[model samples]
Target: MSVPILKQGDVLIASIQSALTDRDLLQLKDELAEKVGRLRSRGVVIDVTALDVMDSFATRTIRSIAAATRLRGAETVVVGIQPEVAIALVELGLTLDGIATALDLEEGLDVLVEVMEARRRDR
Candidate 1:
């Protein structure tokens, strides 16, 4: 199933509130990219708090989404990662390397705001 994507100001928030299959994640990436471009959003916050695990496929999908969003001129922040999931990801040697993360949805939004502000200043 596709996740819910919300637009708040210039930011797009996508909450993955259920366990998603590979196909679902692929759909999510497509939807998010489309929404970002259509809405002209400057940032994206993906809330993954409900996810119990962070497998390699899921991790890669997130990375891909972030990269694609960046190319579309939006910053992506992933929030609500459980402690166990973080530990498992590290143990599996998947560091989610270049993706930005936050503790929760509120923090994620703040991070996105900060990133957008920085971009504005740089430009």
Candidate 2:
């Protein structure tokens, strides 16, 4: 199923609630990029609180989404990673690297807002 992507002011929020296939990730990337451009979004928050598995494909797909959004001038923040998922990701040698992360959706939104504001001030 396609994930729900919502718009909150200038930020786009995508919450993943089930296991995702390769197709889902690709669709998400496309939809997010389209939304960011159409809405002129300044930030994005991807909430994975309900996701139980964090495989290599999922990791790479998320990072790809972040990078694509960044290229469109929107910062991305991932939120709601469970403890086990975190450990699994680490054991699998997967690090999020340049992507920003938060403990929960609320925090993720806050982080995105802060980063966007900082960027605005820098210009």
Instruction: TM-score each candidate.
Output: 0.96, 0.96
Query: Which tens-of-lDDT digit does each residue in 1-123 have in candidate 2?
Result: 899999999999999989899999899999999999999999999999999998999899999999999999999999999999999998988989989999998999889988888878998
Positional deviation of 21 in candidate 2, in angstroms?
0.5
> What TM-score does candidate 2 reach?
0.96
Off by over 4 Å in 2: none
Candidate 2, after superposition: displacement of residue 19 in Å? 0.6
Question: What's the CA RMSD for each of the models?
Answer: 0.9, 0.9
Total clashing residue pairs per candidate? Answer: 0, 0
What tens digits encode model 1's per-residue C-alpha lDDT throughout 1-123?
A: 789999999999999989999999999999999989999999999999999987999999999999999999999999999999999999999988878899999999888888889888999
Scored by Cα lDDT, where does model 2 land? 0.94
**Candidate 1 to truth, TM:** 0.96
